[model samples]
Target chain A: MGKNKKENRRNFLSMLGTAALGGAILSPVLSKAANTALSSNVTEIKNFEGRIEDFLGGDYTNIKLRMQDDVRRAMKKPAKERKWAMAIDLRKCVGCNACTVACISENALPPGIVYRPVIKDEIGTYPNVSKRNTPKPCMHCENPPCTDVCPVGATFKREDGIVVVDYEACIGCRYCMTACPYEHRMFDFGEHYSDGLPAVAAYDERPSFEYEKEWTRENKHDSPIGNVRKCTFCAHRLEEGLLPECVTTCIGGANYFGDLNDPDSVIAKVVSKLNVSVLKEEFGTEPKVFYIT
Target chain B: MKKIFYILWAVAFILGIIGVGMRLMYGHEPAAYGSRVVWGLWVAMYIYFIGLSAGAFLLSSLVYVFNIKIFEKVGKLALITALVTLICALLSIWFDLGHMWRAYEVITRPNLPSSMMAWMIWLYSAYFILLIFETLYAFRIDSGKYSGEELNRLKKRLKILASIGIPLAIAFHGGVGALFGVVSANPMWHSALTPIFFLVGAVASGSALFTAIFAFFWKNKDSEYFNQMIQILAKIVLVSVLFDLLLEWAELSIALWMGTPAHTAGYRAMLFGDYWYVFWIFHLLLGVIIPVWLLATKGKKPIAIGWASLLVALTFLGVRLNIVIPGLINPRVPGEALAYIHPRLSFHYFPSLMEWLVALFIFALGIGLFFIGNKIFKLTEDTENKAL
Candidate 1:
């Protein structure tokens, strides 16, 4: 009985070894086939020379798809080598604020903390008035004044030029909120939209995937609930080879996002070809966000 | 009168307890300060109490380091007041933190070189340690534990600590000023004069409080030396108040004259905004004019100087509020307040009742600690004269 058991074990081991060798030989070919299937639609968008106007006038889906492709390409480089940027074409924006809603939904943001807000202005007198909408996001400055004032070094600039707050480390002195030139940062006062409700909605209590960490607001004293939060260019989504929620949900195709270091990327082209201006440039913050007015 | 004070203290203490309970339970939900005008009464009170502590410590230094004989009687009392008020200041800012529990992170992992706030924390910690040692030595010498030579040795050590403390006090208080001053984003606070202004204000407010405490609380208030000390402290308060006003004038006049709207907006809001009375009524009328009048006209009378100094010390919070709030009233981006319309996003600010209660609690806690400490340590005892 012992001899028969050993012989059965040897037969099983030899079969497993044959299977491992065969799988190794076939793995590369199978992965290549899978890659082709995944990128079949993406490959059609190669060498796209589309301007902001063309993208707006033509199929808006193409621009989003092109940006998705740009994001996928940028993810190949190391974080330090890539510089993420956003450009808002002011001429194309309508005041729908879908991006704002998308961000709120994406981040599970509580009351009093807004990652983006669309600023509306009415120019000229009553008879000749024209309304303008400007969506404001964190500028993610090259020399971020907000990061410099943090007493605990809780908030800092990531190598990819996105500014993030370490919720665990932030003392939440609000010194950064005061120091921000654009006033982009918001303090989470640990409020809830469902405060007075009979039962808390599941959506209101959902966790946000910020900085690739699951931050569930189960307790008011938890990290993101009391920490200062701002836009991270939808960093977690970017890691999954997807565009920022604001960029994808922009109704008028107004927002552009890609790696600025890549000269051929859509954002790099839009920034260089257009006469773009940054808000509060005189402060010398050198904002990564640009606006094509 | 003492019964009335005790009743008030008890009431404030009870209310303050309720406020702290709400703060722990609700977080910042019950507070009014928000993203726009980020700081409110708590921050103002923090500077106010800290200024008092710094001011009191420096006055104590005059007795310990310089050996100013007329100031000798009130020296130990001044040290205890410093210690108590320093605790109050720490509590005020500690509760103001969003994650009050995580406050130790500032010590554990600090970003010193780039952040003015980090420098302020380090300096305050150092100053706090130096103060404890100095107070301990001063009290130990008077504890009747040591004889002639040992007492002299303790006195020498106290003097050495006091001397180290003078620079430490100046740096920490000035560092507080620079914490606000270095924010180039707020043109109002961004100035070379801010640190100097803080030091002067500290001396003014601190000396005024010392004078008041001496006038009202001294055991032998009827003594001739009491009158002499009060007179000298009144003079110090008067000169420092004028000096502080002079700095304020320079800061205001320069900004108002030939300055662009960006630079002048904060001063405009301060001098003539919704809460203009903070500057005009509370600060100018009560804090400056009335106090100055009493000190100048009734310089010789201890009772009159006490009232004047009390007025100055209490209303100096108006000055602190003016410094913190107006710099934040104007939007960094024009029309940003209208852009996002939440109660928390707006620029308008008034201290919520919870905030006031929390502030009251801190003040009561400080007073309570002072009474307890005084009882145990015989803080105001005439040990020095007995030794002499």
Candidate 2:
């Protein structure tokens, strides 16, 4: 309690400083304004302007240096602090793929491609059948089977416990797809976010030749294609200091996000209080996502 | 007469190049194969080629190791074909990867638990070195300059290396089969017979494809050596197919008759299900019944025999397609939609034009290289001119 109070005071102080500076200097990449408070206390905002100029090479005279400042501040927090994790309350989940939808909209995933899904099982049969839904994500496992068997290291668990893919490095062998037991992974197959896509909602909805899906669409290949993708735990959003879209938007309130390493974190507390169990526990994958049955 | 054939080869080569460029410009997703059907043409083609190589090597080993003089003429061609098919097989796997560049990391990382990782590194490397030495020994024996002592020394060494390949051939093809077999999630491919199935296909496809090449080249040329080799090859292909058929019946019968849920789910999806036509019509009839009948018939006309050989080669493709596709399309877990039950499934897919083109390029390259090997190593008995 005392440690949290101290940390809270420190966070409040920096939150004020960041607001005063209009968050221009700090990237706000840290989760929930907490880690940045502890680590970024030194180097006053005025001095940070120097760092920002060096980053921009003094050429941002017309534009607000705040943009670079935000990126820089984000860069300061360690990779661990940059990523936010989600914990699903399996008990709260009603087997509806609401989190799947939230993930689709948030990441602009291609059609038939989902970032996360609820695995439904009807254990037992006929008269006494009981249906249970196990919501699954990447698992972000420490000893990930997909990573172990990738042959290319395309899917690698980042230093901060978040598993990430260097899509460019991936060869589309989908070997990782086979290795994953939970079936949390999926291949892109050059598919796009089609069928029920909200194309109008996109900010910079250009043909992304880099990803190949958009290129296939622009060139109009019947295959909704390019590379391979699955749930990334909303990596881009985490880089910008936001709850994963699935966590924020889940109507069931089945999702919670916080640092698992931190004992007082909501996610940490949930696991501690609920005696969480990871799916395929015997697999020894050390999956970061904990489910409360 | 050979000059005219070269012109046709040049045209095919140009078209193959265009196909590769087209694949790069677009991508592989648009091909008429779904994610479940991911390893359709190219993967099957790869196994076909690998089978040919392994089969040819084993046949060549009979002459080298077992002192069989009757098959001497084909011994060298068999080794070279092995090299060509192996190269084609590697290309198929390379193109299938999600990130094409990091393929070498498989070699560097070396995860021992994964058999694919180990086979991916060892089999190709071992095959390459063996091929080089085998080619050298063949030419050394043919040169007529080497003394009896030197010939014996080289032959002894080649025999030792050749012995290693017999095991490698079984392990390599069996390992590839094991890759699919070990995936117990899909009961269709989960039996102990899966690897045995792959081995049988390797022998049948490998022997048949070799016969196809032999007949195509020997049709115009009067090479008694090649003709005799084809007769021997015909016997091999016919017998291998029977073993392959027996295994298929065993695998299917147990799955269908026993009536376990997993077996029933997989059998229904494959046998009397959506892929029923492919299973019964393509694999059972074309891959098995008809081709075996053609090879077994005693009608003995040369043109008729050549047709049978071509059919065997064509049927191998069907067998490979059936092996890879059936397991993938059927969801391992029943009661869920295709997406939900399938692990690591997202999109329903068929390979695009790009995928087909890249696969074509690989296939053409294999055939082209085989032709070149035939030219260089006296794969045919042409004395006037050689690839050198």
| Local distance difference test scores for all models | 0.86, 0.62
Query: What is the per-residue lDDT of model 1 for residues B1-388, given as tens digits with 9 covering 90 to 100?
Result: 8899999999999999999999999898899999999999999898988899999999998889898887776778888888888899899999999999999999999987999999999999999999999878876776678888888888888888999999999999999999999998889999999888888999989888888888777777777777677788899999999999999999999999989999999999999999999999999999999999998998788888999999999899999999999999999787798887899998999999999999999989988998898788665654453222
**Best of the candidates, TM-score:** 1
Sum up the clashes in candidate 1.
Answer: 0
Worst 10 residues of 2 chain A by lDDT: A43-52
Model 2 CA lDDT for position A39: 44
- Off-target runs (Cα >4 Å) in candidate 1 are A1-61, B385-388
CAPRI category for model 1: medium
Write model 1 residue lDDT over A1-293, tens digit each, in one string. Answer: 66755454454334433543657577445434433443443343222222355533333458789888889999999999899999998866766788988999998888887898989998877544556788999999999999999999999999999999998899889999989989999999987788899988788888999989999988878888778999999999999999999999985578899999988788988888877899989999999999987
Show the colliding residue pairs in model 1: none
Give stretches of model 2 more than 4 Å off.
A1-87, A90-98, A101-112, A118-135, A140-144, A153-169, A189-228, A232-243, A257-293, B1-15, B32-38, B113-115, B219-230, B299-305, B332-350, B382-388
Error of 1 at A179 (Å): 0.6
Distance from true location, Cα of B376 in model 1, Å: 3.1
